[model samples]
Target chain A: MSGQLTLYTYWRSSAAYRVRIGLALKGLEYASEPVHLVQDGGQQHAAAFAALNPQELVPVLRHGDQVLRQSLAILEYIDETWPKPALLPADAGGRARVRALAQAIACDVHPLNNLRVLQYLERELDVAAPAREAWVRHWIGSGLDAVEKLLAGDPGTGAFCHGDAPGLADCVLVPQLYNARRFGLDLAGWPVIARIDAACAALPAFAAAVPEAQPDGPRS
Target chain B: MSGQLTLYTYWRSSAAYRVRIGLALKGLEYASEPVHLVQDGGQQHAAAFAALNPQELVPVLRHGDQVLRQSLAILEYIDETWPKPALLPADAGGRARVRALAQAIACDVHPLNNLRVLQYLERELDVAAPAREAWVRHWIGSGLDAVEKLLAGDPGTGAFCHGDAPGLADCVLVPQLYNARRFGLDLAGWPVIARIDAACAALPAFAAAVPEAQPDGPRS
Candidate 1:
């Protein structure tokens, strides 16, 4: 909290949304620098932003001189440095469960349906719009189905993805559910996920972290 | 080290390979259960393996009754449970660096090129062989390019990704390098990655974890 904190983010990026939720959950304040992912061929690709993140991705958290990339890594850094409202569980097994759930979305679900991948489908692979949407829904459905199964069947799942309190897994799941709805995939079948999303949405942390609530969000 | 450790794995799975390296680095012994991903319509789809991992993926670690999925989470679990020869660095920033490097490969690179994704391109999208290879090479190339930049420009990189130790990043990088070679992408362009791979290969932990050395690896 002592250092000057800044977050390079896109309002609609699920990865960035995860970090936003993490920062909010930690009660940490930071300057928001919006990088439009689709404006004029992606502001993320601009020289300055690319220099900040070699991956040219958003949700890069800079604390004074320290710059951190990858949303999950950033979440962990926040948890480790701040050490309040722990994002992960105390026990190793529970920590593994939370991280596994988080990765299920972050690594498996989110990456496949990312802007860059969707753009590649359209531009490079010649995937038509309908087919592209189908592709997005397909991965999101399969991935969410797995997540639903994991959450629904596990006794560890409480008010959130892990236990009573929302944590890292919730940070990842809420944003993914947002993307899932954006792509028109119904969450009726994923009762557990829907319930967790509802629970997380009730919190101010998750509420403020939604893409629509961001500074760069569509002014409706 | 005392309790029975069981790993459900696939020979050529980069994710599974990562777990193997992690176990080897910790000098932990585990019984290997091979889940044939391609043979007999993928044993990973079998009910038993599905029960172990709802995602139906390989490298599920079972210790006693605790079952873990997702290779990265498993790596952290191993690191936390057995702190000897830490997979992550000690400092918070250093740990973030290692995790970011690991996720660059795990989340950004590998997930897009996984078996299910390629299968989707072929079965759902009807993308042909040359185009599929192009897709694979495209992602691997772009992903590794970012990795090369991260490693090459960072002063934190020593003999390995963090310092003079082979940790989580090396576990991820070696497996990814193996996958890149399998897809016929030349590694000559990435001097930093190649150098780190060479440094890691010289160690018994990594040497023993190579895909070709596994019990279920292709013979001859």
Candidate 2:
């Protein structure tokens, strides 16, 4: 936990945003190295970055010599290494529930709408902007609808996705909602998710991790 | 671990196959409730299954009162609930590497090529069969390309993805290779993955969990 931490990130990438929230929640300081997913036809495709992660994806965490890819994995590594303000719950069942919620967004929703996938839809598939918009809405809407039901139906849900704390699921959920609103989707359809988003936004960790606050964000 | 275990699964679902492999590795028994993802407009849409998992996704593991959704979460839950013959490595770095490899397939590849996405591409956007095939192959090929690099580049990769034992990454990787082959894509492009796939296929745990062996499978 004490080793030098550095994150290869993009300002608007939700995966990077997830890791930022995680680092903040654990009170871990890390240097930021932005890898623009858009400019210059994607910096992630550069030889240097590709050497760091053959996947050529951002949110790569370099904690000492262990270079990590995948936002969920990096978050888990941070939790296991630090073990304070746990990103996951203590019980196995609770941890499973938290992870399932996280995957609901990370796996089902965000992957469909991320920059690379959108680029493929546009550049290769020749999917028009309107249809592409529909594609994004379709996945996000259905994904959030399920997440709402998951949160609303379960009594375990409190102010956040699991319990009152903003943990792994919250770290993931807030970013997806950010993308949803960016696409001009209404949050009214997912009241539970909207409420959780509100709760998470109030937290300093979540607040500081917003896309707009990053070094390479538009406002900066 | 001793509690009654039930899995709501689809025969051809790579996600369900992952949990099946994990259960097999742990030497745990579970009752399979096959929910055919294709037949009858997908039985996963049924209210009975929806009540269990609003996500309407396969590989929902029910352990006593706790019903879990998401394949990776279920696999992790299985590992935590039963420590013997562990799926993840003992060290934090090793565990992160294994999980990252697993997510490279689960989150990056499978989500894009799953039945629902393919159906959406066809029904919503009216993407032609050839183009849809390209979409599938694009994600799968690139995903496996990354996996192959991760495996071949790392000295840690052995007979399996992480070590000599067939663990979590192996369970996820083999099913993905199966899907790639089903799409008529050649495995020769990814030698490391192909080698690992053959190694995994040699195990009874993996062999018994193949799509063809399931009760709902075609040969059944």
Can you tell me which runs of candidate 2 are displaced by over 4 Å?
A: none
Error of 2 at B192 (Å): 1.0
What would the per-residue lDDT of candidate 2 be over residues A1-220, giving only the tens digit for each residue?
Answer: 5579999999899999999999999988889999998888899999999999999998899998889999999999999999999899999999999999999999999999988898999999899999899899999999999999999999989999999988999989998999999999999888899899999988899888998998888984
Task: Write down the TM-score of model 1's second chain.
Answer: 0.98
What's the true lDDT of residue A210 in model 2? 90
lDDT of 2: 0.93
DockQ of each: 0.92, 0.93
Among the numbered candidates, top DockQ falls to: 2
Say which docking band candidate 1 falls in: high
* CA lDDT scores, all candidates in order: 0.92, 0.93
True contacts kept of each: 0.88, 0.90
